[model samples]
Target: MTGTPGTRTGRVRVLIVDDEPALTEVLSVAVTEAGWHPYPAADGQSALRVARGCAPHAVVLDGMLPDLDGIQVLRRLRYENPELPVLMLTARDALEYRIDGLANGADDYVTKPFSLEEVVLRLRGLLRRSGAERTRADDPVRVLGPLVLTARTREVHRDGAPVTLTAKEFDLLSLLMEHPRQVLSKAQILDHVWSSSFDGGGNLVEVYISSLRRKLDRGRAPMIHTVRGLGYAIRPVEDGR
Candidate 1:
């Protein structure tokens, strides 16, 4: 769908990949009601084909499918379009399963029986953040200690060099930097970075945090820290050593 310039006028394009026909129809109607164009796919192969042709802004993927699994679909999508955001849906609640999905490139995953309003809200948030990033293509780079995130090029740098980050990692870091020194709850992080469809019981956020720490804290002092039972925050190391 076409969007008007300088105004939030266009419908966000969304691809719904689910084997259940009933679920797909319900989701399509919900997405349309939420101001997005929903494209339905009943299997992995069809999803891939539609993704290639539609180039949707984001995808809502179900874990179970007839042919290829959701994680596999996510991997292939990442290979084809690294920046494409995806919200995974599954009935599985196991931590290992959640980690596997995230490792395979899913930005977020929602458990079965999720509310339609929740899903639509999450999609809108993800689309809003994505749209904002596109609009800031000419803005100055944001520096946080040894870390540098360029809004213009969608690039992240460490010290004086470049660093490659998955789409979700960058989004997480961006959200943290935007609220530096302020602790943010896992739910807030998921809503801002992965979309509201996330439902992995905070494990998804933990895994991404671990990945970010490895990349952003290799040689430098740690900046990302967990606040005990509260949440997480990013700031300069306080020891002053």
Candidate 2:
């Protein structure tokens, strides 16, 4: 959807790659309401065709297609526009698949049966951040332990190595890192990372947090913490704990 009166200058264009006509229509309507232009592609080939022609700011891609897989689509897009932001949609819930998506250069992934609002929110955030960096060229990088976030590049690094994070995980990490050692409630996280129309019973945030812990906290100094009966925080691990 478009922002406010003064925020409507250039429209954010999105190319959706999915074989489901019904889902694509629904997404198109939602994206239109959110002030974005939506281009639909029913298969991987069509997706690439549309993407090449439109050169969208972002893409919403499905994992499965009749001809080519989502990974192939991602590969082509990377070849054509390496820096293009992609939001992959898949029904697979397996951790391995999610990891594979990241490994293959997907900017973000949303499982099937998702809320339209969540999708729109993610698109907006990605587009906003993408453009925001150009306007704030002198912003300093944010660091937390091994993690390094560059607002200019919209890139994250862990120990000098590039790390891929979904939109939600990046948002959550940014929030926690902004207030290190401070507890943030689930409600707060929801409000910050998701649109108000999100209605997943808070499970969505938990799922993404688990994903982040696996990717960002494994074998590390345990920066992300859970406060019982309260909320969550990210801080350096105590010497003994």
**Backbone clashes in each candidate structure, one number apiece?**
1, 4
In candidate 1, stretches whose alpha carbon ends up further than 4 angstroms from where it belongs are 1-10, 132-241
Question: The CA-based lDDT of model 1 is what?
Answer: 0.75
- List where candidate 2 sits over 4 angstroms from the true fold: 1-9, 132-241
Put down candidate 2 lDDT per residue, 1-241, tens digits, no spaces: 2111111223455788888888988888887787666777889987887665444678999999999988999999989987888899999989998888878888888898899999998887777767732432343445454455655455666544566887768888888777767888888888888865689837887788888888877877676788887888876444223
Error of 2 at 40 (Å): 0.3
- TM-scores vs. true structure, each candidate: 0.51, 0.51
Error of 1 at 74 (Å): 0.3
What are the per-residue Cα lDDT tens digits for candidate 1 across 76-173? 98999888888889999898988999888887778888999888877777767677335433334454544556655677765435678999898898
Residue 192, candidate 1: Cα error in Å is 44
Q: Which ten residues in a row have the lowest lDDT in candidate 2?
A: 1-10
lDDT at 58 for candidate 2? Answer: 85
